[model samples]
Target: MSIYFWGLVISIAVYLLVGNYAGRKVQGLDDYYVAGRKAPTLLIVGTLVASFLSTNAFLAETGFAYDGYAFLMLALVAVNTSGYVIGALFFGRFVRRSESLTIPEFFAKRFDSRAMQVLAGYTTVIGLTAYLLAVTQGGSILISDVVGIPYGVALVMVWLGYMVFTLYSGSRGVVLTDTIMFLLFTLVSIIALPYLLGEGGGWNATLTALASSEAKPGIIAWHGLTGEGALWSSGKDALIWALMLGASWSLVLAVSPWQTSRYLMARSEHVVVRSACIAGLVLAALYVVLLFGGAAVNLVNPNISPSERVMVWAGMNMMPAFIGTLLISGIMAAALSSCSTFLSLIGFSVSNDIIKSQQWTEHKSLRMSRYIMFAAALVSLILAYFQPPAVMWITYFAGTLFASSWGPVAFMSIWSRRISAPAAFVGMLAGFLINIGAKLLDNAGVLSLPVYLDPFILGFFSNVICILVISRFTQPTKAALAYFETIRQTPKEELDPAEVKKTLIWPVIVMISGLTIAGLLFVFYAMPYAAAVGREFSLFSGESLLSIGYGLSVFCVGLLAFWQVRRVYGRKTAQRATTR
Candidate 1:
């Protein structure tokens, strides 16, 4: 077998071993669903980052960069960072305090309604299954491409891997394996980027070539009037892009059931805060490398069809075959990590929420979870094998479902006292239906919506309006109000004032400064240079100053991340010593 095949084998072997080891720790339902709520800060951050950096980022987002949407990198960074901060601040502590195993359960407890729980559970399962099908299909394609195997065989192998790891180990195994994969993916991507950039003749020549080529002129333009005049017509498109692509997607990640489970698994409220910050920083740094690498591929081989393959092609062509194989394995790691999390969440929804088996023993519940996991994996595999149109059409469909259905409800549950269980249920159903209706209309060409007018915006607002209107007419139950007050009064361990100042306050300052500087660099230097580049820009010239500038900005952000992690962990160590 080739080195590429060996890399795949080793990756699969490591995941199986980790799953077996973690499976031994599964003593009850708690362990299966939430890792017994003992996961440390680093582990939580690892899994969260791993789950988010899936094939979507590896392929789809990278393809955008290759197609000349580099500005999206900045937009995504801003939106995702804001999302992490918002989630950590508003949702993380409250949800973790609720001690709920799933997002639907949190709703049920918060609203004191079994009906809402069932509705949320089914909605999550449907939305998450759509996402899983897409991810699994993407993974199968990647494996088939790399291993030279038939798509059908690769599909089965991918399915088996999902079943083995997630079925045996549950959340504990999933998170642990996620952490390992996150590290491998990050390290490989980071190592592969500079070589890829070099092969593209550095950044300057690449941009110049792209600018002068027959490809869309807007590919090189960052902001303002594009050379094509249609790609980003005005600031309206930019705002819409930021809102729908950046904010809505981030909102889904922030409030999604699969993601909230990570917050619930955290060891403490402090860990939740620290993990969010770490994840945000790690994601920011990685995106810098991946996005730039994708754009750089335009110079190495401009004719790479189906732009999504640019990253994969760059890895195989730009690096040694062995290293290339390892880099390609990172894509597989991304796919499996994300798919496993979704599968686990789907299983939790069915066995824990849908079944409503209050009388069942913990042992019985754990066994049922495993059985559901196997069934969910089988369903996903079959869906992928058939290559349904939903795979392509459901990108925003799934995000809109989660964000519209749960976003408003989750916000109201934590922050609003007037939201009744009935209102919450009605609001969620309304949002879900509105989103589906809009999607059907858009897909059928009955109504053509602007690029900015996504289903998420429609569904979210519809849900909010329904919630506000319905709650005004319907009184909240006294029991629900009382429970909300009790949770509100629960004494949370306050952060040490000095530690907070150093870790939290300073990191925020550093991040804002880094982003501001990066933005200025793009607006003033990089954007103008790309627009002005003519035939004079040489391919063999010295390193691109623009590329170096972007790299430096990324480095500054990364530096702040390292500083943040060290400060938080140092404080954690000091606190442990004091307790001892």
Candidate 2:
């Protein structure tokens, strides 16, 4: 057998072993759902990054980069980082404090309505099912290409791997394996960049080839570029694209069931906050490397059509046999991490929220969770087999669904007391319906809506308007008002102001220094150079600019990793000493 096949087999065996080990520890619903809320900051960071940075990063975004839409990388980084930052600053502590098992449960409790909980639960399942389908399809395509198998067989294999892990280990298995997968994928992704750049004869040569080739004009342009112009228009559409995409994705990260569940799994609010920051930084650094690698892949082979397959082609052709095997394995890891997360979320929503099985024991609930996961996996497999639209479209659809249905209600529940249950329900419904209408119209070609003004933007605004307008004409129940007061008065752990200042000092310095350097580079070098070169300006050249940027990013990421590891282990050491 080939080395690639061996690698695949070994990786699968390792994952199954890990899942079995974790499965033994699953004693109750608490352990199954949120790992008993004892996960450390590092584990939370790993799972959060692994779950969110799935095939979307490896497949979709890389495909965009391969097609010379490198600007999408910037847009994605800006939006995704903003999402993490907002979640850490505003939503993390609140969600952690709520002590809710799921986002839908939080909504149900905050609104004082079981109906709202059921609605939220159903919506979560439907939206996340769509997401699961996309991830599954992406995984199948990658695997089928690598193993030289039929798409149907690959689809079944992918489903089986994801479902088995999810069924056995639940969140515990998911988080543990996610941490391992994150490390593998991050290393492989970073290493792949230099290899591709080298294969393309370095940055300048790569850019020259891209510019001279029959690729899209302005393929190197930072603004006004897209994969299909489905989510962004051309020319003068950059600002709106950034705003809508940023806002919509940010809300999804803050309020989506799968994302919010990570916060609740944290050991403490402090861990939640720190993990968010670390995850954001790690993700930003990784994307810088991965996107650059994807762009460089065009130099290796510019004619790889259906662009999504470019990364897979690069893995097979642009690297050594062992590295190629590892890269494909990393892609599998990404797929499994995300697929398992969504499966687990669906299981929880159905068993805990929708059914509301009060008479079941912890053991029974655990078994039911497994059964639900299996069923969800089967459903996702069917969807993947039918072949969905492009992965990014489905991703955006699911993201919009979550953002419209849950975003406004989540923000209002925590920040405002005047939003009645009726208002919340109606607003959520209106947002959802509007989003559906917009999508149908766009898909049917009945309206050529500017991609910048996508469904999420419209639905979000609709939700906000409905809440404000309807709440003005309605009264909140006394019980709901009391609950709001209780939430308002919930005391959080206070950090020392001096400690906070000390923690802020280094990051503030680093930010200022980095921004200052960037400004100087742009003002003195990039602008003058670009103006001189005119429309032929090559952004990838100029004294190894891309190399320097990527190097610094990697260095910063190393420092962040070291700092986090030291902090976590230092605490352990101190605790051991005290015990002695």
Candidate 3:
């Protein structure tokens, strides 16, 4: 009856349809898990976007923007860029070549140890569950806020909807539905950005309010160690590190078990590399919009009661009632796309890593994965019902654990040949335990250290130190050497060097256009802030014609890329490879 409920219903219907459609293809395990490994670049791109940008992002990113003690966009830019580059440079080639279904499979093959496979699998399952819990928390918060329903009830409704889609369709459903959901979500933001900017006094009033008020620093300022509190809190440095090295390392090395699930869908290394770069740039641009929206909210209405309501508040204030409903639907779509993947990942991990034995066949394995899905969703739902109101903390813990626990193992697998099985096992153990221990210690006030020195930072170094020290006493396995060889071996099916060289022109153009747009957005924010304090620039004026020029550049590059794609398609007969 409420707008939130209606939005929820519409989102549910779309997902259900996707599930039903995808179910027709689920003849066995492969289709259920990785869509028969035939996913085109577009669907893979959608799933990547949807899975990473969960409800927590919608809430925390905007909340962080409104918190105004940090330049959230800069952190986003750093981490995302680092993650993409890392993926493109190293992990992409390794993972694409392995041809494994799960991250643990890669580990098992690389390390020649079933134990390492099991360890990686369980660690991913547990870590990702925490991440999903955080995502669900944000979704529940939105539902509760809109319909005045209990959090537990809202959580159940959201979880049940996710289960129907994930269980029936698995990753196949995730890819298809995510594509639709991503488009809807992106459209909502694009539509809302212009309308909100116009209604909130054409950016002038918002800028003045943001600059003059003392509620918080603007979005570009550091988040921690304010006027007097700088002596007590390490939020500033922690925020910066989280955005920079932390994001990049975690994302790039993530191909192990976490992102291996996504890359498995891509047909070749080239597709994965190109898609990741494009996705990274697109996410960066989206963050700029979301950052602007979040900042604008605080500028127009400095009352930050419930942090999660930043987007909702802006929507209600700026748009018509009907459009407000559509915005909420967009949020629901974003949340659902993420939740589906979380469910699928948890299920797959539990089935393949925990319950099923190595002797199991494909059909049995797939069935077990579905059961794991049910059990995981049920456990998370129960946890969500009792979770504390601070949804952001859970998300932080999840990200920290994943980054530290898997980051080292994944990095060593590709980067080093000397890392032994025993060393890998012990390193993962030390990293996982140290990370958890660090968090517990900090929370209990048992030790007083910089917050940045938490489990993530500690565990990362611990894995490295443990592996290096232990490997000195151990021998490398044959599988480890084999994996190294695989990395060295050039694929027979790789794209033609000459053809790829031609495609390079478009990607370069796109990159330049993307960078130029980023520059304009930065200036957009800076000029408004400067103008609020009555400072005017000479000659170049922050509001110069260059912004429009950059916009046109993006269009031109897009056209060029389209033409290249068509030309490549036209030359398929001549360029087609003669061998697999």
* Most lDDT-accurate candidate: 1
Candidate order by decreasing lDDT: 1, 2, 3
Ten contiguous residues minimizing lDDT sum, candidate 3 = 541-550
User: Each candidate's lDDT (Cα)?
Assistant: 0.75, 0.75, 0.69
Name the candidate, 1 or 2, with the larger TM-score value: 1
RMSD of each: 5.4, 5.9, 5.0
TM-score, structure 2 vs. true: 0.87
Candidate 2, run of 10 with poorest lDDT: 490-499
Cα TM-score per model: 0.88, 0.87, 0.88
TM-score of 3: 0.88
Off by over 4 Å in 2: 211-214, 224-233, 489-580
Can you write out model 2's per-residue Cα lDDT over 407-502, one digit (the tens) per residue?
888888888889988899988888888897898999999987785678887888899999999999997788788777776542423243333334
Pairs of colliding residues, candidate 3:
69-222, 69-223, 83-248, 224-236, 225-230
For candidate 2, give the lDDT of residue 495.
Answer: 40
lDDT of 3 by residue, 1-580 (tens): 7665686687789789979989888987778877887777678778877777777667877776676633434444444443643554456657767777677777888888889888887888888788778888888878887788888888888888888788889888888998888788777887787666665676666556666666664344323224444332444554555554445344533453445578877766656655665666566567667766777776567677777778877766677777777787888788888888888988887787656687889888887888889989988888887877565677667766767777777777787889899999999888888888888888899976564565677888898899999999998877679768877554645546564554455467665766677467446655665566576743353233323433443444345444544444324424554432
Cα misplacement distance, residue 486 of candidate 1 (Å) = 2.0
